[model samples]
Target: MTRAIALHQVSKAYGRAPRAVDNLSLSIAPGEFVVLLGPSGCGKSTVLRMIAGLEEVTEGELLLDGEPANHMPPSERGMAMVFQNFALYPSMTNRANIGFPLKLENPRQDHSERVESTARMLGIESVLDRYPAQLSGGERQRVAMGRAISRRPSAFLMDEPLSNLDAKLRNHLRAEIAQLTAELGVTTVYVTHDQAEAMSLGHRVAVMRGGVLQQVSAPREVYALPENVFVAAFIGTPRINLLRAVVHAPLDGRMSIDLGRQRLPLPEPLSAEHQLLRIQQGRDLIVGLRSEAVRIAPPSHARPGEVALSGVVEHVEYQGHEALVHLNTGSQPAVVPELESARPQQAARRRRRAGGGGTGVGVLERLRERATGHVGGPVVSLDEPVSGRQDPHSPDRPGLMAGDLVVRTGPDMRLRRGGQVPLLVDLEHLYVFDQQGRRICPLPRDVPGLDV
Candidate 1:
């Protein structure tokens, strides 16, 4: 039978430095598959290691099947782990490697039957005699998984086991792994930076950033209703289009979003949710529009939930299946920093708050203070609240002055680079985040199978 795992406010750290895995708390139901997903150094691996008892928990508790397992050793956790680098025995043949754990437990017992069964299950029966060095990367990965499955562990912890493989092989193995875990009816916690892998392989995904849990919910819920700006921007492909916008709410007129040179009038008799935008009037907030949320259309074809706008086509990219059209709208595009830098910044903030000290912390603070403001002049930075009227049309804003809005469209929609094009923004699908990177537009929780 499978086991339920619960991490209650768990945190891990090396020395007294900031927590590697912050006060993270999550529950995985018995036999359910959960993916811990984020960019590199986001503490996904650390969380997995702590669950596996491979790393010590600096604070809080870990419960396995309603029993505290904080002090348990890795071998006693009733779990099997598949590492990213394929931690197979280099000198051993596939057959021996697959049955290594079983043999270690019962030295005299012949585990050939069990080993062969797992080999066949994983479609690796032909490579049983080959050593790790002689096997291909995919073959080696299967052998490693075979070893883990042969033990009949209660839970499986896979840490980006397919990261080293090519795209084709990763896709193949991803399906195989998902099927195998379901068939075995074992609870699983998988870790990966690839959102595709996380969304496709798990029943739910837990997104992490800077060692802190961002959002944990079903894949569709996380994608469709991201809890914050980071989740919204991180989950989508071609990235979600973000812009600095101001809310326009008149006493008697319908509410709208002011984009400097253009405006989107929200649907009238606004639903309770859209009405919440009124309180944000005249305040600069970030607006997010998924490529699919906007489409090329004329005013006559515009529907109730969609608003129209015009822009100059900057470029067109043919992506085989569809085309990506870049437009120059008179607004500032919001830029999200790479997680590589975010990791350090988050750690520094945690240190400063905790009154800790280190060379890394000091250096980070110095860099933050020395960083220049927005564009040509000492104007409001992207990190700061970008009021709509503050230098609206100025070309001085460094990263994105004239908003480079990219819209996903069908291949048949062709246009010249400088041609004018009309587009529609789906009001129902619009996302809003505050200056602090927290979601604001989606005030109510409407996602299914989610209580947070």
Candidate 2:
């Protein structure tokens, strides 16, 4: 059985420190596989916990199948949660671990047949008799999953279930999870910081940050057209290249974008949506390009709706099928401050909890401390538009400039370090965001269930 899920203006706060999840609204169709993806401590897990009734909804409504479900306990909600840490009992055998919940739910009924069926479904029949301590990480996870499915809940909620495993095992288990959920046809909400996992497995991916839903869309839509700088930066491999640029209004009946040392001429007669660039002329903006957006080519090789930019190769990372070419394109990087700050916040939280908990300071005070390492310090670009604003604390420039951007290219190309290369930019694929990190270029219409 599957049920639709909805969060209307949901917010979660610890004490009165603003919201961990701020006015987030989402709707998941029945049997949908949705991934809650973001860096650590971005409130993805908190949202999952709320759905499972493990956490209270401080504000807003949680609807399960169009019924208010906020007050429903975990067991009554018919939702099974697979935790990050394998929460199997140390003393229980794999069979006992898988059947424990059903056994406890109704002691009179024999759970052995159901337990055996689930173990067989997970391909863990060989390990069913072994104790959890005797099984490997992957085997233990299978048992944990078996337990979740044994009860056959209406929904499956996974909170970074593969984070503890090695890469090989993570990949293996990820595929298993995807296949198992689809086979069960259960409404599945999975949480992970691994973009690769989300892209490959989720029917729709919800990108979150600072407790806010950034973008929720099909994986291809999320990647090809990110809703903001944060999504663009977080979703792609080698990260999307973000650089400050000045939009040049139409001159000689054609427009151009000035990327400091390089300029790209727009095709004659800009599309109506792209004509918005005229208003942005002379305005500072951020340009986003995926590794695949730019290729090693000259103007002659430029396709229609493409521009040429020259970059000096600083380094090359040879992947099996492709190479990540780090190039100095003379564009100031538009770093996503949120991703940069997540690690520090996580580290600080771990340390502070170890020290002891207390009522926290206001949001402004917290952001200020995180921004400047001092309380009551003036906040920087975080509160306002970063568009066109130069970094006030830029490090002194050395005599030489290395690649501040990485471009994906085919691995067969022989490119040496310090070599100059011309890259063709797909004008249609470029993304432009304002100083506030919101996507402005391509002029995306409202995506369904995507919060502004």
Candidate 3:
């Protein structure tokens, strides 16, 4: 029997430290696969532990199959966990390790048949009699999975189980795990720092940052409609091009975003998305363009909703199928600190200073308020005055002289470094983020009562 899991405003704190998991609420349906995706120290594993009954929930509720289960013991949760380290008994043979859990659960009954069946399912039957040290890494992990499968648990909690394996092996096992879980039809909560794994394996991906849930959606939606600057920067290959821009929406003139040396003019017939830029007139905002959004073409070849920009090529990385062209567009790149790690204490202090005490609003409501600019949100703009002088260049790219934009193109196009290239940007695919890092353009479909 599959189980449903839900967390309502669940939080975890250690002494005076900032919350490890802060007011996180999510629901997982029976037999659904959900992935908890974040960087290290972001509390994804803490969440998994809480769900498995290994960690205490310091605040709020944890429901198992719609019943409160905060104090339930780990063994009683009917969940199987696959750990990163494989966690096998060194002194025991693979067969003994797989059968150990069954022996403890029912010592009087013989589990040899079940153990053999599980081993066969994982294709590890040949290695059952050998010690863990004698088997390959993949074989050992298969044995561990065999052990978990023998239990027939209601839910599966996997904590970076493929992190220790080689790239090829990890990919192979990732497919196997997906197939195996689908065959079993068990509710699964997987934790991973790798975005590739999260996008590939999850039916729904929940992105977390500094213990706070950022965005949760299907993989395609998460990629296409990121809710904030962080989500836009974190999920894509080659990363999205984020440029500091100023919206100029003069009443008598065309609306445009001004980069350092170029201006992207919005087409004469302002789109509903572009019309909203009037609210941001003369204000600093971040503009996002995925690699696919821009093409290496001239202004005359511009398609409808396309704008023109020019850049000097700085570097070219030729992958087999395509090439990533890094160009100097004379545009400043917005720096998001600690993109791969968590800083809960600083975030917590910011919240307190901003009077971030619970407003009793749900997550969707809060997101809508930020996106619509109807309510104040966290301001993260380059124009904001600060106490200390900051560098003009991004720390991630030094000595490139504003090589801040990257565009993907066909591998067959041979371009020389320092060559000036004309580009066409599809305005229909443009993204705009306010000073608060909230996406403003392409308004969320669910937000209502907004004047176009």
Candidate 4:
């Protein structure tokens, strides 16, 4: 396939104000499936509508197959679009719905044969006799897609076409759409705010925010190496964690970051061309780390580049295999130390006999000393003594203090409400960003950090 579509200095505005699509320029390859991803009112649908000629361009040109298509009408654009609300006529049968476009366009073609062929391809042949009102949500959606594909347009444009389906059906159709688009070998542009759909279906993703394209790249590339802060925070499930931090120094290929009060290093480095951003040493910057980049663990011996956080378990959200635990930290705490705080708090309670075991500062002293040695002050350790007793003067005793440490752990990991847990972070996977919110380090898979 060749370049199927191009937009040059495309600008669209509703009134005498800032443009909705600001001077956008993009080239879409033939047979490549691209998805415009963004939240509602972010101009994703506007871009698709303009390409389909549903909206008139205000200040630029749109080309289809190397020919300017700005003056073409919707019907003449050589593209088919499916909408969120499947706009099928309730009185019309599925066959008629799929065939109507062809019938309207061609007075000579046999509509029945074309409709049936397309119905079979979408696995909706059995529903051809049923009206839109008689079919299930997924079935109706399929009919809409079938109708669009039946036209055999040069390109397919879809705008959140599966938003009305149930969760299971939505996932099923997500895969089905990917398969169908690939099999049809037609250039396609899909618009959706759903990150899962974009990751699952698009050959490449174009992320937009406030009418500006944030990034345009393969789904995995956009997920792994986002172009900026907006893409980094918006593209993943549970989203990537953004923490305010500062650059310490560059070591080997990685860069150390001070997480406000604490210091930890990231596994990657800034692109050579953007290395100057890293010069703002100790200046406020934002660091991004994906959920998968950090793991929750019980306090244990950790090597260099390993950071731990300690906090009490505040809430636990069970998600079958793993649980998301919100830790009580005074700061926007890290996750690992929360787990460590759990065990030690429990252990110290058990060691105390009567008189509340007055003054348990020994443990606190040890931890505080440990914190001083670490970049950040010593983190609290979880795990109370095996015995169930309370130790006075120990920070873990009563009136639990809020400290930073949060973790998402596995189901089998024993933790209780009001209990402390040490959160062991795999600092090797830490990610750093510059003041502009651009990543300054490589991830672990592409580069190793301090041998974990």
User: Model 1: residues >4 Å from true position, as ranges?
Assistant: 339-381, 384-403, 448-452
- Cα RMSD to the true fold for all candidates: 6.1, 6.2, 7.9, 13.4
lDDT of 4 by residue, 1-452 (tens): 32399999898998964568887888899999999998776688999999999999998899988899998898767789999999999989989999998888887878888888898888999989989999999999999999988988889999999889999999999999999988889999999989999988888899877677768877877877776666777787665666666666654455656654445644344445235546767676666666565555654665554566555676777889887666653334222232133676456446653334446765665555455333222122222223433332257565544423335568877778777665556654555555555565543233223122
- In the range 57-95, model 2's lDDT, one tens digit per residue, is 999999999999989888889989898899999888888
TM-score per model over all chains: 0.87, 0.87, 0.87, 0.77
lDDT of 4: 0.72
Predictions in order: lDDT = 0.84, 0.83, 0.86, 0.72
Residue 85 lDDT in candidate 2: 90
RMSD of 3: 7.9
In the range 1-452, model 3's lDDT, one tens digit per residue, is: 99999999999999976688999999999999999998788789999999999999999999999999999999999999999999999999999999999999999999999999999899988889999999989999998888888999999999999999999999999999999999999999999999999998999999987788989988877888889987888889988888889999887888899986689999988988889898998888899999999999999999998999998788999999999999877777775544623465356446654664465444444565445321122434364323232232335543445367899999999998867899999998899998778999987874332222
- Tens-digit per-residue lDDT, 24-60, candidate 1: 9999999999999988877899999999998989999
